[model samples]
Target: MQGKLYAIGTGPGASDLITVRAARLLDKLDVLYAPAGRKGGRSLALSIVQEYLGEAVQIKERHFPMTADATQKQQAWDAVAADIEQDVKQGKQVGFITLGDSMLFSTWVFLLERLSDKIDIDVIPGITSFSAIASQAQFPLCMEKQSLAVMSCTADADALRAALNSHECVVLMKVYGRFTQIRQLLEELDLLDHAILMANASMGSEICYPDLRLIESGEDLPYFSTILVNRTWALN
Candidate 1:
């Protein structure tokens, strides 16, 4: 009997936010794989679901390098995929956990490409950080014919500007590193007052800046930080 691979999303940060559907699968997993960004690093995804995980489930933390080199990153994921493939082929119910939604800007997407054709797979979607942010702030993402755009801030300056100009609401992911540049673009478009900087959405340490101007223009934010730009709503 070939075992199946479960691709699960654990939601943003809070454990209670995890879907009941995803929570039910935790106890049935024989092996749970969690991703670490560097060697000896902790897995945030694992931590989020640790309380609900069954004690009998074997924990496997694999290092998924955070880098720009596509070849290097692929090699690492290839090794991880091989491990998962072997486990599933061995008839062990394997689970790979991802933070937030499984499909959005997730490493799980890359793994799916490699293992989808080889074995049985089940996907369980979880709430995204941006979705949590909107709910927590009581800020509607879009309404009354307003358009919404979700994009990574890692893109070049021109592309960033386009997203701001085009969308009624924009959820800027991975904004910590590009904080200054993103802020400048918002300022250029006169949307600085409409933007909110939030870090660790739904977590205990969550910080929100309803007024983006209060944040230092040159200061980088936490790694989990995101910027919500709502042009139609008065954020400040």
Candidate 2:
């Protein structure tokens, strides 16, 4: 009998937010592989799902570098995938947890690409940070006849501008690094008044900025920050 691999999304950051299916899978995992962003950093995803993990579950916490160097990232991904593949081949049920949805802007995507052909992979979806943010902020992402665009701060200026102009609402993910620039652009588009910024959504550190103008010019938000702009609604 061959072991199966599961890619579970642990949800935005809350433990209770985990799906029932994901919870059940967590309880049955023989080995849990958690990825940390830095060499010595703790796995935040593991923290979110630790309560559901079985007592006998083997925890394998590994570091995946967050950098622009493709060679380093490729090497780390290859090594990690190899380890997981080997474990699955040995008939040990393995699981990997990711934050938000596994398919969206996640490291799980790379793992899936490498291991899909080698093993039976099951992807268990979970709540996304933006979805939790909208709930916490009492935000309605869209309404009838209103289109929504989801983007990232890393996007080029033209694309960002186009999204803002074309969509009734725009969600900007990973906006911390380019907060100032994005904020300025929103101001230029006269959409700043319609926007809100949220950091660490659903987590204990969660903070919602109903008015983006309230943030100082040099202020830096957490890496988990996001911004939502709705031309149809003027945020406080």
Superposed model 2: Cα runs more than 4 Å off: 37-39
Q: Write the per-residue lDDT of candidate 2 for residues 95-144, one digit (tens) a residue.
A: 99999999988889999999999998999998988888888988878998
lDDT of each: 0.88, 0.91
lDDT of candidate 1 over 116-149, digit per residue (tens)? 9998999999999999999988877988888998
Task: Give the winner by TM-score.
Answer: 2
lDDT of 1 at 227: 88
Query: Which residue pairs in model 1 clash with each other?
Result: none
